[model samples]
Target: MEKVLSKKRLQIPQVVAALKHRNFRLFWGGQCISLIGTWMQNVAQSWLVLELTRSAFWLGVVSTFQFLPMTLFSLYAGTLIDRFPKKKMLIFTQAGLMTLAFILAVDTWMHTVKLWHVLILAVLLGVMNTFDMPARQAFMIELVGEADLMNAIVLNSSIFNAARVVGPSVSGLVIAKLGIALCFLINAVSFLPVITGIWLIRLPKPVQPASRRCQEGIWQGIKAGLDFVRKTPGIFVPLALLAVINVFAFNFNVLVPLYAKNVFHAGAKTYGFLMGANGFGAIIGSVILAIRSAHGPKMRSLFIAAAGVSIFELLLVPAKSYTLAYLLLGITGLWVITFTTNCNSLLQVQSPPNMRGRVMSIYTLVFGGLVPLGSFLSGSMAHAWGAPAALGLGALISLAFTVALVIWRPSLLKQEISFKWQD
Candidate 1:
């Protein structure tokens, strides 16, 4: 009994091995604070757009504008991230985002803000994030080596979702009591922690290739990354699924706000709570992944999580009661996190050290790039058929795609991912 208890005690540290690394801890703490503010701005932005336009189509337009740059620039951004020091690059990107947030805040505070202003700022933010997302994703390896890579990724997801929970809840209160501008202002201020953290981070310099790749030009690097993905089934299959998910089923920003207002006749607080419910479920899923971080990927589990998300989302379409809809959304959140975390951890673990940045940029692109397209379609559907129809249709498409993939390539589902790409 004593031996068994000792083993159990020893397992605790293994679950949180990434936290032991000083650099990761600093980055994680600062990013946690900043991401909370980011989520606040996300809720506020959607609400602001909804208030101003009263058109689901316009709401989709705003989302499309904001994320378009990510699709266009992410491939190039990946090359730049690989060529530079990710730490310093992130500092610059964070500062740029902070500036954009401040401008939005001030404009709204002065009562001079317009829809066009928000749209243009969204474009700028998207451009900045094109650079930021890949750098941040790739930088994780430098903080904690391969042995703890999955743990670190899972922890990062937990932090992101934790912010998702707090940010939306707080933003709802602030929007109700204060104003929308304050949310952006608070988000602007929130960047200070992450910027300061980046400045203070100390790590051994990354080893450079004997000959720098940039000297030959970035296109070569981009081509190599593309080739790697095309040739590798392990990465290709998951990435293909991610793109489908993004295009058909990842329009939560557009769907949730519309549902709150149209279906429930609820205010910002209710919408915020619904968003918070999703985050809370995500937190639960993240914790589970963190605890089981050491385990290898289960092909069956991955497909099930994907299918689970679509099923719950479809069920939410017919849910008439607030409680039922909220519960379904939470379940959707849980499975979405599980599916996403699995994709991210698998990609990171599989890629070679030199290609990690470019690989992750592809990851970011698929994850975020297709969002604009999804948002636009979802909004159009909502405008014509209602929010429930839009969400249900998207979810159905995702489910169909998952089923088709499994049937077309059963080996893709059965093969165990060894977490390393073969050269």
Candidate 2:
């Protein structure tokens, strides 16, 4: 175990090799721009939905709409990734996303936007993301080659967290002045960098198979992904942890508006500030991971991070006052980013290039798709128990999940979670 773990550790620095490549920079830059915008829209969309509906139930519902498609659509998207140029696919998705954002802005600006309109846009966005996410996940290799894949993943997290910091702060300011419509418009603009990045970067051809293999369709890919997960508990365990934790504790996004409106008595700007503060913690967490001295692929770091998520979630539940809740949530966001980023890093590390897209699609499905159902349960439970009790219960569930991971995956605890080709 130690020898295998040691070998895996050494692979960590190999991903840093991406910085040496110029094309990778273009791709990274574009991703950073788009991600920031995506975060901006995220903050804006949640609040807007809350404002329009003023119902926490629907907030969970809208969140569900966005992710449910990924659960349903990701397998097919992964299959398509095997069939198409990832870069071109991303371009189409990005363009579709930007156009949708613009249409939302136009609708809102014209005072024609309704709750149903938002739901429609949200669902369409999910469709765009289903294709965009897996392709983007796979395309990172073309930018930097495989040696620096780990670094690219880490750096991507850094950019994402950095955007989390920037997007909400700016979006909050914009929302205070302009409203959610303008925030959507800004999000549309963010897509430009990614589009440009696609236009500029040189990509390597995918290792072609002699023949296409498709014994089934979306369910087939989904079953394949689940089968992969079942065989690799190192991967599936964390995924189950994510799903269980999210069902109880991850409703913070759904709850944020309540925290702001009912608890804090604040408006759009305050909501943005709350999100931005959380982003600060996320930024700090990502930077720590990016610069962690742990040599090799230190994915055991994720187990630690998952533990942090469990702890911080408990912190948020009994928060006596609104300020206390805000602080706990900000810290929770930090831990949240830490765990997910590490999970992604580990998933990418252990997966083979041939099955990478499908594996990651499964990862995405577990991470995001499962969450909507979780949110619904959390919201319903909260609706019954009151907010704090619901949140506390959720936190406890997450903690239990992390504890199970530590017990079941002793290999992960040792930071030895890799599967190499036995040549």
Candidate 3:
């Protein structure tokens, strides 16, 4: 009995090996709390927009403004991330985000919230995220190093999805009972823990950029990052696949709300429940990745996950019942996280230390930066043909793109390179 107990204790760390590191544990815990608030705000904000405009196109517009900064300035942000301390950059960005949430909360509470107000706040939030996303991604290496990097990334996804599950469900309850303003207020308060966590984190001094690299202009630094990506096929292919998937298929912020409200004649509670179902499946996928972290990423896994996302999305097109739609979305959520986590791990592993920030910035650019375009496309389509048709069309484009990508680069599916990190 004692031996079995000891064995179980020993096995526990392997499941969450990244938590053994002090810095990552601190940041992860804080983020775990904070992201739930972020998700709450996401659900509330979408429902709020739908309420104000009664138009899906406006919802897309809000999403477009929110991510446009990433599209416009992510390359510059990447160069800045490489040049400066990511931790400090993150602190500033998080503070900015908290402030925006507060402002929105106040406006909503006062009953003066306008569509223009939401749009403006969203653009400011996007500006903060432009810096935050890449810096945060690149910072993971410093937290746990390459030995546990995959675990750290997967664990991060796990918390994010976990928050997705909790936040939206709670937001529905909060929005129904208290008000939408309270969701934004809670999100504003949630940033405190993460900011404190960042402040407390200690790290070995990061390698400063070379004098020559630092001396170069921002545009030159951006050009160099682009050139590196262009030369590296391993980094390039996953990003290309991500771009297609993100642009066509990642319009859930627009599609899900419209589907819940317009198609089902439902309310905030229904929207939250659907989003929560998706988040639940994503958590399951994250657990799978966490268990397989020791093996690192596989190209085959990446491609298969991408196909699964499109296939599940295609299934969603035919889902006429809420239960059917919910089930399909849950499966879609699983594939979405798996595909993205693999792409992220693959990119980080393939990038050199000096170029890591720039590489991940490009990753952020494709994964998130292009979402504005996708939002607009999906929103416009949803407005015209309905949410199901918009979703089906995007899935079809993504599926076709995935197929062509494989045919053009057969080596990608066959290749599964492994790496040993040298401190």
Candidate 4:
């Protein structure tokens, strides 16, 4: 752990001071608050579904509902992002999420929450994210210019992982005491930081329009993004690995409580502790990346990390003790995020900016689109082969992906990432 912290060799921008941008600082602070709330809602919402029905199938169904909007709206949303001001679009998203959080809180507090409400809110949130994810991603470069691209990416991961740490543990306490509604309320409060940040940002004037190209139509843009991916097997190859991990290891968000109840015979607090451990590891990984992420000579360490995740995923499956499970889950979070954040940085550096919006939309597509499938498969797999076996298979697939990527993009291993400033 200490060595990982010290191994800072990746070429960060000389302008390590991008965080000094008043607007970027505001954005970062607000996003950190808001993302923590998002994680809280995720944990609370899943637990609420299980509480209402105690059925994993219902759990899978609700998860599916949440992600359906992303599948339906993502491509068009990316096109809209290209055409509009991302700052204004994100303000809308943040405000809308706050509204959804308030409704969820009220429903839970009143004890009137039902499975349908969960599904409704989940889908609505997904719809909001369809626009939100793309806009926010494109917005990152604008925040600090291309000079701070790596910093912004690492910092983004930091905000998310930080919230992951605080949100779940706190939500556990909130859910156990005031009920899940409190978790929702806390999440609503979380959005305030981001809203304030957005209000504070002084964006550069919008770029002059490129006359709409032949690919300006929404479906046409979608096709273009797809074509780009098909031709650049390099991008898709690494991307597919992340997608599989999300379905199997990343989707573990929906499975922790199941693990708590069935495997460890623990309650909400215990489950919260498990989540916090994972978050802790995730934060550490993000910080390490932020500090010394490689500019070139892509590390062979990613392959090793992929293999470690499989082992950790397997270790958590049948563990009888919470202590043992926490250790495994922490390791699981660390390696998986390390692998993912590194891949995103590499892909971002390698991709052309003209097509960045579309390339990123494809990133969102696989990232979110695969979840519903994973949620269903994981739930069903847990139902049949047992939780441990299902997760083990996922780990195995991840290992296979790592091996294939190394073989296919051996040049990826030789190329060093370099940062260039944009006017």
Q: What TM-score would every model get versus the actual structure?
A: 0.97, 0.89, 0.96, 0.91
lDDT (0-100) at residue 423 of candidate 4? 39
Ranking by lDDT: 3, 1, 4, 2
Model 1 worst lDDT run, 10 consecutive residues: 414-423
In model 2, residue pairs whose N, Cα or C atoms come closer than 3 Å (at least 3 residues apart or on different chains), thus clashing, are 9-296, 10-296, 15-148, 15-151, 248-394
What's model 3's lDDT at 5?
100
The prediction achieving the highest TM-score against the true structure is: 1
Runs in model 3 lying further than 4 Å from the true structure: 1-11, 209-213, 420-423
* Residue-by-residue lDDT tens digits, candidate 3, 175-263: 98999999999999999999999999999865554564588788888898999999987788889999999999888889998888878
Candidate 1 residue lDDT tens string, 351-378: 9877888999999899988889999999
Please provide, for model 2 over 124-172, each residue's C-alpha lDDT reduced to its tens digit, 9 standing for 90 to 100: 9988888888788877766765556666777887788788778877888
What TM-score number comes out for model 2?
Answer: 0.89
Decide which is better by TM-score, 1 or 4: 1
Candidates 3 and 4, the one with greater TM-score: 3
TM-score of 4: 0.91
